[model samples]
Target: MSANLESVTDTADLAQSLREVFGRAQRALREQSGRFGLTPSQAEALGYVLRDGPLTITALAKRQSVRSQSMGATVGVLLEQELVTVTPDPSDGRQKVVTVTEKARALVAKGRNARTDWFAKQLDTLSPGELRTLAEAQKLLGRIFP
Candidate 1:
């Protein structure tokens, strides 16, 4: 094969591998959140609020690529669970902002700790050299992502 074609093929394989690994990791973390009785959409919306501060249902819907009504239903579940609070936007009374509640923070922290504990156990099985290589690979991944 030509060198250029070979490089493209290798990149495509690597992209697929990364996607599969990320998907599996997401599933594993999702399982941890499931313990809190949260659906994937609810958990994802909560995560976005936690990470990005308060946002409107429209904003969240745009971020998630879902419809406003769909996001409203997801936020409704979060509100019902007391995981989020909705208040009128100070600057725009016509729109409401969704904010994560303290209860949601606690749940997120617990879920994070659970996932970290599980990951740490898996890391314990790796040799020191393997760990170092993994760390370097993580840095490369960061460059690709960031």
Candidate 2:
């Protein structure tokens, strides 16, 4: 409660800690996603679609920070796998929107469940204080992200 923001030193340690935590989370996701035979980017794109609903290729590209052409290719794979379908936009006939299919939803849900289960198992190893700290960290992360 007595902490001060002024006169702060270099934040290399804080930055490195964040990087390591993120790396571990990414690795965990990779293990779950690997079972589905998707590249990280593809998995990410599918998850994004799951969370955000249908989007056009250009919108997906912008969200994923990739080029439109690259996003188009990714969408092609999703389409070929029958994970998503492209339909004419009701408001704009010239544009097509990509939507997730039941199969894709199932895949995403399975990955999420697996990760949740794995993490839950790991959480059992932590003490009450550590669990409290982690709960606080989750809240802090939500604030930082949102």
Candidate 3:
């Protein structure tokens, strides 16, 4: 095979590997969140707001790569669920900020704990050699992503 062809093939293989790895992790988290009656997107949004509260819907839309209207709808669902609260911006009454409530905070914490425990159990099933390789790959991924 040509050198360029081989290089392209290697890159594609690596990309697919990364995609599968990330997708599996996401699915696990999504499954855990679903147990709490939250969709993956809703769980993700809750986690974000829990970590960075008092964010505007527009700001969240930018972060989540959705239109403001879409994010507003998402936030509205959280609002209805009593997971978040919207208050008028102190600086601009015309604008409002979304913040997580105590209940949602507990929910996020529980979800995180569940995910961590689940992954830990899964890792325990791996052989030591496999675990070492996984750890090394994670380090490499950190460098590549960071």
RMSD of each: 2.1, 3.4, 2.7
Q: For residues 1-146, could you state the per-residue lDDT of candidate 2 as single tens digits?
A: 22444223235567678989999987886686464877767877887787899988778999999998898888888889999998888888876688999999898788779888888888999999999999999999899789
Q: Clashing residue pairs in candidate 3, if any?
A: none
For residue 122, what is the lDDT in candidate 1? 84
Stretches of candidate 1 exceeding 4 Å from the true structure = none
True lDDT of residue 60, candidate 2: 91
Model 3: CA > 4 A from native:
61-73
Name the runs in model 2 displaced over 4 angstroms.
1-7, 10-12, 65-67
C-alpha lDDT score of every prediction, in listed order:
0.90, 0.83, 0.85
Candidate 2 CA-lDDT value:
0.83
The full ranking of all candidates by TM-score, starting with the best, is 1, 3, 2
Stronger candidate by TM-score (2 vs 3):
3
Which candidate leads the pack in TM-score? 1
In model 2, what is the error at residue 72, expressed in angstroms? 2.6
